[model samples]
Target: MSAVASWPVVLSHGPVTLRPWRLTDRGAWDEIRRRNASWTGPWDSTRPHDSPEPPLTFAGMVRQFNRRARHGGMLPFAVDYRGPGERRGVLAGQLTISGITHGSAGWAQAGYWVDQRWAGRGIIPVALALASDYCFFTLRLHRMEVAIRPENARSLRVVEKLGFRYEGVRQRYMHVDGDWRDHAMFALHVEEVGPGLLARLEDQP
Candidate 1:
């Protein structure tokens, strides 16, 4: 069974929601990525040196995400949440369940990014818990892994907040930003959270 088929198109918790990425999201993406280049570029992944062709167009990126969703390899989502009379759901960031595996593996990898403005608001941990719980319970995935660059303290804090067990450090695990970078890998098994990741996190005070 495909993981995407069993999941909600829009997953919500409190005022936060995670909906699949869309072609119409280009504007928001452009605005955020452009304005936050100094903040996000150091962590964003880049193509290999030998790869031909220019970077993907916004439309192409959306098409690729849609294709991945259909293939069951990923669920690309846009994180939306409400804030002090700021409208019901603002585009806050993105969270995705990528590299989904089924059959005997029954696992997936998670990746995310939040607008800097939303940092320290407890929005990320809540969003992550919601996704993690859905994967463990509804999708019946046995494990979920989150790998973060060692220097990405904010991201590491997120896994910690949710109590994802640290597995190990991966040396040059991925090509991030420009060069290969080491990452701290963390994971959670279905049994690790008896109640659910969201329930285990205990909403911030």
Candidate 2:
């Protein structure tokens, strides 16, 4: 099996940090979701009508992510941002590296969301760079992918800014916002960013 980081691994770049979720984070997480429900609902994935999987609560989701992490199939990160001179960090969002495949494939997908209040500050992009670097250097994954709904201009710009090469689209790729939706796929191979994605982000002109 390919290598994987232990559960609760933390990755950081400046004020943005990606760490595992805690049970105590439910309150803050719930508030963020509730407040941003309208903002994020359109892009959020949904269960199909015929699907057998039950809805997952915050605790249940955390447990599942942790269980998957043990087997090297998932990396669930809760994004935290600490402003300059701040002693403690506040929850900013979440980024999960899932769908990990080992051996020949050696690939994984990253998905993320940020609080509207914290959006456009380069936090999620930094978080993505950190996660991608960990997957490339630490876990030794070959490629990292990000799928975004076609209409999500904000998210689309993120991949563009981070230099993830456009890899076309998947028709009816995933159920989202009450129906199956096409997603624009973008990916970055380890070889494509030898200098590291984080450094590339910092070097943007």
Off by over 4 Å in 2: none
TM-score of each: 0.92, 0.97
Write the residue-wise lDDT of candidate 1 on 1-205 in tens digits: 3344443367888878988877788888889888888887888878878778688898997788878877777778889979967667878888989888877999999988899877777788888898888788777889999999988999999999888999899999988898888989999999888999788777444
- How many angstroms is residue 83 displaced in model 2 relative to the true structure, after the best TM-score fit? 2.4
Residue clash pairs of candidate 2: none
**True-structure lDDT of candidate 2:** 0.92
Identify the candidate with maximal TM-score: 2
- In model 1, state the lDDT of residue 29: 85
* Residue ranges of candidate 1 with Cα displaced over 4 Å: 1-8, 52-54, 203-205
